[model samples]
Target: MRNYLTLFLLLFTLQLSAQNHVFVETESFEDKGGWVIDQQSFVVMGSSYLMAHGMGRAVKDASTTIKFTKKGKYHIWVRTKDWAPFPKGPGKFQVSIDGNPLKQVFGESGSDEWKWYDAGEVDIKTETIKLSMKDLTGFNGRCDAILFTDVPKFTPPNKLEELSAFRKKLLNLPDSPVAAGHFDMVIVGGGVAGTCAAVSASRMGLRVALIQDRPVLGGNNSSEIRVHLMGDVDKNYYPKLGRIVREMDNGDPGNGNPDAKEYGDARKTSIVKAEKNISLFLNTYVYKVEKQNDIITAVVGRDIITNKETRFEGSFFADCTGDGTIGYLAGAEFRMGRESKAETGESLAADKADNFTLGTSNLWASLPRDTVTTFPETPWALQFSDEYHIDNTKADWEWETGFGNFNTITDAEKIRDHNLRAIYGNWSYLKNHKSQKYAKQELAWVAYIGGKRESRRIIGDHILNQMDIQEGKQYPDGSVTATWTIDLHFPDAKNSKYFEGQEFFAGTKHIKVAPYTIPYRCLYSKNIQNLFVAGRNISTTHVAFGSTRVMRTCGMMGEVVGFAAYLTTKYKTTPRGVYQDHLPELMSILKGETIEAQP
Candidate 1:
């Protein structure tokens, strides 16, 4: 009887194993080839996917090795979206198993939403198989994940929640995240603001963890995006406030420079790595936060490629993500877009509150070559005639998008794609239509990462406004000085006449103002006790943000926040407590005075 029972159990286990499925995340591929991991839409798409950003030329194949338990027929499903669905999508690619290319072409389903497409079935004779994706158009083809299952008539989940659960179940991920480490401060961004904060806090004898989603730091000023640091760092209310920011500046490379080294990616990385008290975690995205009442207890981040989740606990946290991602997750009070003139009492404020805000730019540049260069016709890109096309070799901040038509955080991928179409179409016309003028010009660099201007402004005790700058309002908690003009951007009227709703060009008018200092109260969240916000997301009206949003000014905000953080740790109080109770100590630290805590 015992022998018979054992035989039945063995058969049941085999059947279960045979029906199992294999899931492969494209971002986790060992060899990604020319494909790049894009996490801009991760919030809406559920995960980071691989994108072939070849700029019109087909990229090298992205391949990985997969193993199967038994040799049999399996069905395949690929998660992808046709980024440009109208007039046929340009991003088309094919999947291959063991060296045999599949018949189904991906990224052409005419659907804007991300969904799984069935790729039929294939016979597997070997346990080890080579899986790969071949880009056909090189117009930003994307693949999220691939699934192979032995169970017949099986379909993968399409909804975000269901898909997330399915992935976890299939990947066998832990229910709880692994503890990263306890820290005095956990900074959620690696931009200039966050980098300065980490450096300042670390130098002040606090253990810091700087988490950045991308491989490199400097945010928009990095080589990936290539925007130069602007605003005045040398002229400050507190002379010592922008010292750290000045140390990281790599001279003005100008926006959309072709050379990557001019952006100083290595210099920024080394600066953070040199800090002994700072533990830098690159390529980590923070998606969730743990909160107790109004205070954030911890933040949960996942490895963009490996998908491993980590819990970072800290006594205090800083929201320097520019998008205010940490503050949003922690339920901190925040505002997006513009405010009404009646509400804010500012002259620059709109008559009524709406979704209008500064746009995002994906700058591109071309260089003169020794020989004539040719570019392919982009039929799938935004069509432009000689009468209505931009006639420039390099695109500066003028090549912008997502002013009122899209959300900077949710529709980031769409905005980026629109910018690409505009860029390619314009360049094609310049190269092919009017070859004489731009015959020797070759496309040098195009930013796949969009340089954003504004997003969610996490509300603090004080919301800086336009009058405060024009009037030069003084506060006892004056910190970082703002010297840049209130430069606000709007869609170019000429481009609007041609592109209408999808205008890609931008125009800005600079409103000059005397140098003014931002209050320290504007650095910490009003609701969330332990939260500190810097960068463009700090408490500010849309007009005030125009000046404060610049990288140099934002970096100084980080320096002030860092000093305030030290006061919090020394006094064992919240950010507000430090502002109300220990303002003198924070002011002293900002003035270059040393105030060590008693042991």
Candidate 2:
């Protein structure tokens, strides 16, 4: 009897394993149509998903092809979230199998945790079928993944590790990584500095790979984020360094989706594409790095649209990612927020070290219409007191938040969402309240991309402090000239009275200082050999960073690093080696001299 029971159990297990199951990643759909690929969340169901940001108008349907084997009753499950679980959410969506709509709808049903919702079983008759997600509300409805299974025992995995493994097996991912080709230098960021670095390096006859996480170049300056290019470029030191920036700048002010040319999005793309030696990979986000000892071997990036992974191998690498994402993954030491007065004897340093870095901004603008406009009441969103209500038509750099204990990188989704709620809530109050100031105004645009001011400071060979900027302390190896004053942003005291440690508006305080040059030593990782850095993440005390964090200064830094990277490839030397033994060689490049003719 025991032997018979064992045989029956073994057969049952095999049957379950052989049951038909189909897992479809919504973001991997061939024709995403009008849906936006939302990979911003570190806290997501899978790697990333698609969002229907129709803003109340139904977006075009996103559809994909699927093949089914066992033509029987198959249970359908979808992974999604109801953004506002407390009150009735605005977003709602439904899935259709083989042109047949599911009985139950999704998006408005689940909570913050992305769990599977049973969308009722369907009888399968054909081997091939079309699956699509139809949006009901023009609001931000999202879809992560869809699962269809014949076996009753099969359940979708919720744990990340288990889900990842399941996805790999189901998707038939290769055991080996995909090679994305070799390069002399790989600059990961695509912001002002990273873009300049790639251009400079490519122009100097070096093979370069420029990876940007967004669809367009210019991190904050891009129309998606809409921050204008600030600080002076080509004024001091290497005049040729800012040439690329000049070509790319469209000179349009204010932030919105008025037109593509306003932010020079097309112009930047054209310039980068024109470079013979530069391979521009837009919409690719780097998540991992492989290192041997202190040398970085390769970086791994995922295609935001296709959900494909690629390994980017390079002889030299640059951490131009504003958040120091690359450096952090490769185990590089970094600092966050203000330092203690005892650590650095700067007058601006706080008495105690605290995690209080500069805040991120979500700027919004309102367009005045001839006829009166009404905004939907967002009672579920954050509320403001009558006295503190800002009856304004636009929000700019000062409209910032995310100081306090919020981890900029990890808690990014929450921060951006808060800004969205704030924008909607503020507009609703303005239009509906007894105050008739904004009755004729309509929200033209609100940024989905949060423009961050500060984050991780990757430690380099030289840690520039407040005195370095204030005293104009010159380093023999200084390469990039930083002209901005010792400027710092803090939560507005008036705004803080309401939010307290979570103020969304910021106030700037500046002290004029003579322009000082930033040392090349501050542009490379201290321990991570062969890894260079630029932009806001470069080694600097919180006080010093205040002056050096502007986009143009970052561009100059990138230009310097790009030249140094060429030297590294030519001489086959590490970043430290270039600094100690070949300091003049780097200076020669900054001085706009030929590499071979340098003394």
Candidate 3:
């Protein structure tokens, strides 16, 4: 009986090993076609999903080929969401296997929360099968992942922890870190700021690693989020600071509302690739930071597509990540939202400290055509009162939300959903209403990636405030020059009356300030010795952030940080050491690169 039991146990283990579990991430498909990858939401079921955003019409089928070990009956589960579950949702799609459409269609009925919906069983006779998603309504149907398994009662894990383990097992990922080589400086986040920092540092003979969470290098400037470059560059004190920024500029003065051709997503990429000392890693999100007392030692980045983790070790680390992700993970001192009047003594400061930061935007643009286009009605959305009739077809920077006391980092997905719902609902009213103002308009594009303005600001040796810009205070260590107005955005009181807590429109109150210099002390962390920061996440008061948050201004800050980092490497010292002991050397480098901007 013991021998029989041992044989039975061995057979069961073999059966389990033989069972093939194939998981295909739709976003990983090489030929995405009309399906756009939605990655704005940080905490998602998996990395991200492919979204079919055909406005109102049905979209082209997103198809891929999957090879199986053997042909047999397979249990299929698709990860999808209804998006609007108040009633029968508009977003719907059907999965086709081996050119045969499944009996069960997905995206029409499911929880708004992402979950694995059983796509019913499919009988596969061939070793290879073609998988396709046919869109029924192009309102915004999405698919995160698809699973096919022959194991009995096999179900894809729904909980995040279980799903993570399942992914690791299925991908055969290494338990230990994969070495990504060593670098002098590792710059996280690849917006205008991070890109410039990488380029500048590489030019100065420092081995640099430029890591971006998204597939593209430009964060907000990329076509995914679509915000045009703002603020004046190559001016004020640091004339040549924006030379790298100019190389990647879209060139057109127009925002993302204009033709897609204007935004040079490829131009920025070419600039980075030309730098010999810079190693650029796109579609790699840094989730973990390894730190020694007061210093970050390494950061672990996971590949968005392959589910592989790589450890990047560097002498110096820059938190160019606009959200201050690395700093937060390293337990660096940081602040978010508004500050009390006593905190910074700015005229516009709040009476008390509160959680109110500039909102994020999921902007939309519309093209006018001679023929009429149809947009579906989204009655389930947060309705705008009849008093507010939105006749405009295009949504720009003003279309913002998430200001109502919420953590923009943790609640990113919810914020994005609110923006989407507002866009769809407002469009529905404009198109279906008796008014014919938008009769010939069609939405060309809408951003699924949220264009954020503010988040955690890492505390540094010096925190710039409204008084700094307003008084034009000059510092001995001043590096970058900011020339934009103190433009602060708040929830529009008029819109709030109609939508209540979920106001979408934001109004900007601008206070023009003279072009002022930002100090070197504002660039590096106070607590974390080797940490440096740039972009909007740099240490600054809320009112001061209004002026420095613009892209071009942030780009200049990056240029200075890049120079400072090079000095740190050359002198074998920390960021603060470069400022105190090597200020003259740093200033000499800045003086050599001085070239005036064109009038």
Best by lDDT: 1
lDDT of 1 by residue, 88-165 (tens): 688999999877899999998888778999999988899999999999987899999999988878888787666776
lDDT of 3 by residue, 162-257 (tens): 576566666667888799988999999999999999988888888999999887877788877778888887575756578888888877545556
- Model 2, poorest ten-residue lDDT window? 590-599
What is candidate 3's TM-score against the reference? 0.92
Clashing pairs in 1: none
Give the alpha-carbon lDDT of every model.
0.90, 0.81, 0.83
The residue pairs found clashing in candidate 2 are 56-138, 57-138
Q: After superposition, which runs of candidate 2 have C-alpha atoms over 4 Å from their true positions?
A: 1-17, 42-46, 56-58, 98-100, 434-437, 596-599
Candidate 3 global lDDT = 0.83
Error of 1 at 178 (Å): 1.6
| Count of clashing residue pairs in every prediction | 0, 2, 0
**Residue 38 displacement (Å), model 3:** 2.3
